[model samples]
Target: PGVTRDRRYGMVDWPGWRFRIVDTGGLDPSAHGILGAMRTQTLRAVEEADVLVLVVDAAEGLTGVDRDVVALLRRSGKPVVLAVNKVDSAQRESALAEVFALGFEDVFAVSAGHGRGMGELLDRVVELLGPTARATSDADADADSVDADSEQADPTGEKSEVVSSGAAADANEDPVTDLALDGEAGDDDDAADADDHADGDDADNDNGHVAGNATDVDTAAAEAAEIKRFRRPEGPIRIAFVGKPNVGKSSLVNRLLGEDRVLVHDMPGTTRDPIDTPFSVGGKDFVLVDTAGLRRRRSVDTLTEAVAGKMARDQLARCDVAVLVIDAAGGATVEDAKIAGMIEESGRGAILILNKKDKVPKSQINSKIDETKEVLSFLSWAPILLTSAVTGAGVAELPIAAARVFEQASRRISTGEVNRFLEGILADKPPPAGPNGRHVRLYFATQAQICPPTFVFSANHPTAVPVSYRRFLSNQIRQAYGFQGTPIRIVLREHRKKRKSAPPERN
Candidate 1:
């Protein structure tokens, strides 16, 4: 009875064992209306879990949330196995050092997508599970089959209050959102989870995994974790579902996740805070963030709504992609474009969701899509998918399309390749002569950064570069690199050859 829509618990079948994983929806407790309820459920998960799998994004590295969780796991007195998920390849293995800084006794760098390192992670978990696993299940025999393990005896109504007040304070300093699971059990993974779970053939039990040792909590260790945690997430892309109020953002999230983990209502602000849920599709890990819908800035007068709106925007900035949901029945509006523009300004990959298809006639779907696309032309780079969250139509492809877009955003090209591509552009159409009658001589180009790949072009006449030409260069770069669902940024800068100063005489 403790479980609610805010938290959903489920079991997974390994080769020899099964474990119940609880997904919780965490909201800010200070504004404890719904969040307080979520906190209660999360505490229940802690009390029940024999061994907590503290999953940290290996691609995103160890974060402050990881440190806070370490503090929580320690307080709970529960055995914990650190799962540094999304370590797709060995190149990312080096970042695992900082995860050990949290004082965790055992750590496993794994790819939850590829199922790499899972066997060992699960092996150690089986070890901790011990005899307690059988007893937990047998005791909850009359209870829901799904939560048999998760709903273990609440013997010590409270467990010696392991979470110290200080630890709670520190952990709450930057609390992680407790969003829940990926898909429904018994439902075929191929049909239910966007048809994207890795094939059994692709999953390898071995990736040379071993129990990692904890490191000393020295200043250097903390600083190193800080540096790695803040680095741009590489493998498991983060996608945010954002749009105007009552546009089916939460419904779409539930449809894709194959469960009602988030509360969906006709009320405008049903979702008051952002919740981050980790899921996998096609050997690719991703964080699906569901955010509260945005209202017009002028209309958002209440302090509460304002904070929620700001947090939604913050979630957008933290993500690698943003899926803007539009209601086909309501049609595209100015506010929808504004929301998309916000995603564009953040330089995140965008996907347009034309939801509520069941409510719209099949004859009018095309016209509606065309009108919406025309209205939100600013987000033309974003791919549009028509769907009915009610019946789960076309939702299966969201994650696949999003992963493709995230790839383009994170795409990198060699400097030589960039220069060669630029040469073709220059040859196709020569630069317009500057009004000063000086011939514009462009030197070379180099890619500056990615996640919305940016390129910097060095040239003598930076001021002479027109908006039209800049657009042309962006179009050409996208064309050359095949950046279909992502935006490309190009900058023109003055390249003044520096005069060599005479070397100072040495003593």
Candidate 2:
């Protein structure tokens, strides 16, 4: 019941309405320490939220804390919907009478865990949100319906046809033509014909010219639309802020978001759950996850802290970018290096944030960065920024840096471009002889995947390739492609040759 230590935001999409649902920490007015800080955070949420859903435990009845929270909500002058949770069965519905004493007009006996009586509760909550929300929702639904109808009525399928053709053309188009490398060939005749068709019609008459112009216009429009769709990111980039306790992770999040979205106190482990808050800066969207501070396994005393640590590590794995927030005043610690190592292992784009820079004297800022680099030399590729959430210094550059890193991670190098780059590398410095004194020949290289862009190299003896050579290739690729702030993977595979069959013997 005490798991949630901050406000967790989730979006609710109904048939015609969409709303944001925020789950806040348990409120105890007289409590001290972390629990007291949680109460303060809940009060801030109560002040900002348009509607409140007060869930009281039906089994425990209305406690003093519930009554106090209710009093606080009433003072905020916002709509409150009382949900009596844990009403699992019809027999348990009788417990609502006790909760009704809390004086909430819209009380619904619900079972959150069992999924009982939730529909009615949501209906009441949506109703309390009033007409403005419904109007916006309806407008969005109408636009979506219009788009669907337009797609359905397209009998010619011109849009789809052009998109497919454009994609084919892009696939076949050789961006690098000057480099003559093996296994790199020109576009086939069909692709050439498609390109010509897109360029213009093959007729001399005035009518034909007009028709060609129209076709050219359509092709250009389709190509632009396809490019836009291809470039659009799937969703908001999720950047997880992780570090040891009291390293200013939550403070940095609050500073970046320009609000106290999560509870922040001097206490270590003040934040528990990974709070995902949608944020946008410089025309790009991102989800800033403020995770609980992670401590060593030996130091984790309580079960709650252990769970929080696990959750923090899990967040680090799923995030697009892991921002390791180190305490600048304290310098990088053993725990900080461990977290940075975890980020490297996860293969996610990373940024090092030296937080609380104000606490570090100006004269020692450079020295502190050098000290941190020495401790975290394993993650030297990750860009480090000196920041102070208290003074809003160097916080604005965070999202910009994250966007650049994400772009680098998501970048894809075509096979021809990769092979051409490989050719240049081979000419500069070929692979060294193996331990068996046999020459290792690298036939070709191609990108297998992206998002921490993975490249596969086909060689005569893949196993004989040394680690130093692999590192050299990776460094060269990064030097050529600017894959900074992200790790690039190199995979070697044996290039198998086709064997000739003994036809006479088989007969």
Candidate 3:
């Protein structure tokens, strides 16, 4: 076991076996003081795993940290499988001599990078695991399911707990959110209700015959209930400018906001903490988060940016959309690709902003854009807009694009349209056949939620649909109804079989 600041996962799938094993190295606390936070997060992920496999280095034989990990795992009471790695390279039967001293009954000598001795190691580990491990895994999965459900805003009249939490956090951070969406309508509605009360036909007249207005009262109540769905307040659309250092993120923020809200400097890592500014344009409100430039995790331990980078990612995760501002002259660097991957993984709507457009020559501008797109092929769906934040050229379009992406993200499809669209897709090219030689059938699809409109699909062989087929379906959906600037998730489920009808009430 060794200490790694970032998490990593490995999978072992032995074909013909019904079970799978996910292996993660033991959580050895980071040497850096600030990186100590990772140990807590590591414990959380490890605790959720079905089984814990601690791979020890045979070259190092046994380390003091390895003993600490064993002690910690024992206290956690999680079933720990120890595999002494690098045995073949160590190439001696005596490689695990020190490891054997620890006396874990299920220990085995193996090489993790290669396939040496893994089968025996896994077989013994599986024998140690009883049915209870799977049960515990499912229980943990259910709890996570409940947590995800709780985080969503309910469309009914009840206010979601997340809604209240977001509101409080937003109010504490920026007062401009108060002017965003929630309060703007209530005052007008209350005034109109007051005037209606003042009229002579008021229902408050005690023991009076208000028979003619009874329908109006009922209708108003019904209308109010319907309006509540649309009236629910959403926090200001959070837009984050994310990229490597010295990419003009702060400068872009100032250009759009008409003020130097954050510091600008020629040197790298000038801005250390994330700065947020709330503003509205043409009555559309947004919260702009300008985060510190992120460096590689290994290099960030001593830099003040160590903590800032984490905060930046946290901000990026909560944003409604992200503006990836990269240097046009620099092209897409490795750090830029990492940031783009983060945007996709976060499922945020993105607009790729190629800043410093003025420095690039006119003849090679299109080629540069093409090269950037090729570099970030995974984000090809995201709209790319060229601009120079310094000169304010084409800068005004950022907000308008943000508004459009948000609108598209929040759009919902009717059940009829979804089913109709699915019908055409299936008729054109059916789902591929399963391995059992049975034809896969996509029974139906429905939109379960909006704002990154998620769809749930029912299929006869849900597990058999290949990734290629899913991608084709997603592309077709995009073509039929545009979701250009947003990402949509598809969840699959087994179709419910119709129960055999009681042999008809015949007799």
Candidate 4:
């Protein structure tokens, strides 16, 4: 097993025992700060362990650092075992003698590579285990308890009704939770109360630690699902590829994955469903959705094409970035522009992928680019890249650009930053005075949360801040902060004290 280090201490499981392993991580005992922390963690692990196993390399021989580790182990006054690994040949047997000088008399020689003397090594391990070894009968007892628990609980008995009901107070203002905890309920009355609680009619958020508590449980379950979750790609950038019939979506996907994972074919509408495959670029995870090519209903001559088109539209809804794949050699078409409009309407980040660039002439490329811009001028902001998935030309850079856009999509300005930006913008273009003689004073603002970061701005006469001015502010925020692909929700709330201080005015 690979060594796992948390702080300075690490741990591993041996048969019938938990070995608290420690890694010094190359800290000089004479050094300060880090060395002191390492020593502290090492001493803590040694104090807790029944048997301390000091592993040494047989081929490399002992070093000065190993001496320091041995000294630390000896000072602990605990049982120590020396495991001299990689002594496969007789010539290396002499190397073990140098390790013996450390004064660990109970040294075992073994070869991890050739599996030599493993049986004898195991016997020594058994002897070291000694008193902490669990009796065979106790193993049977654990199995019986597990079997009983499994039968009594739900098949997915992770949270069970008892555990959930115990925290009902968190969800709603139910007295039964407190009563159960206090053991104040009568047996007959408790059942009736629990039945009412199970009805799920009330909406309460009493469990204050719900989010924190459920993380470990939910993380383990998600890992069990075999879908690895990591940071949303480096820059929160996202790019999607979409096109009309027979455009190389699958071929592009296969190239992106660096394998023949997606099935590619020459036939039009080959992909019937949208498939999402994720990979990392610049320490960020980018999910590439290989969607079916779409076509307008008037242009679609077959039933199969219609199904593929619907699938493509469904994929667009969940995407942050979109790439409109155009067949460059096949020439620019009006249908491609229509598909590009759909991406813009989705409010997703957009990119234009001009595929088959190798075959197109340089002069024609500019004309094609101009043609595309003329047709899809609505997406004037999105970048267009010339790529060939087959040749792997310009394919690598697309994922990075996609990740950059995604990061911009998820970008949220800090409260301080937002207010500062707001101040500067106002200094340049102040909110116009209201018709009712109320001056619209925009005060502090903060990012309420994300998923498309919401901004809450406190101001005097929030109603006086016109819709046009709000849009102006939103645009300023996006321009300064680069929330290019994200839809911003601008909220104008009257200053809390001002709203609260006004006495009830007669309506």
lDDT of 3 at 403: 87
Compared with the true structure, model 3 gives a TM-score of: 0.54
Ranking of all candidate structures by their TM-score, best first: 2, 1, 3, 4
Compose the digit string of candidate 3's lDDT tens values, residues 1-507.
Answer: 122222222222333222332212134554333233334434644555445666666655566666776687667676667777667764654867777788777777766566688789656655555452233344343321122211211111111111000000011111211111111234454334323323333223222211112223232223223221221145667788888889999889889978554556676665555555566888887777788788788777554578678877887766788999889998888788898999888777889999999999999899889988999888887889889987999899999999898888777765435656766677678776778787676654555455566666666577898888888877888889999888776766665533346776766
lDDT on C-alpha atoms for all candidate structures: 0.64, 0.69, 0.61, 0.56
Q: Which model, 3 or 4, shows the larger lDDT?
A: 3
Off by over 4 Å in 4: 1-240, 280-284, 329-334, 370-374, 432-444, 449-471, 484-498, 501-507
Q: List runs of model 3 lying over 4 Å from the truth.
A: 1-233, 301-303, 498-507
For candidate 1, write residues 20-133 as lDDT tens digits: 555444322232444454555466556656667666666667555456656766787878777776787887898888877776788888775777888897678768777644
lDDT of 4 at 168: 7
> Which TM-score value belongs to model 4?
0.46
**Candidate that scores best on TM-score:** 2
Clashes of each: 2, 0, 0, 17
Q: Give the poorly placed runs of model 1, Cα more than 4 Å off.
A: 1-231, 501-507
Backbone clashes in model 2, listed as residue pairs: none
Shift in Å, residue 375, candidate 2: 2.0
Cα-based TM-score, every candidate: 0.58, 0.76, 0.54, 0.46
What tens-digit string does per-residue lDDT give for candidate 4 at 428-479?
Answer: 7877788767666654455543434456665656888899999887788778
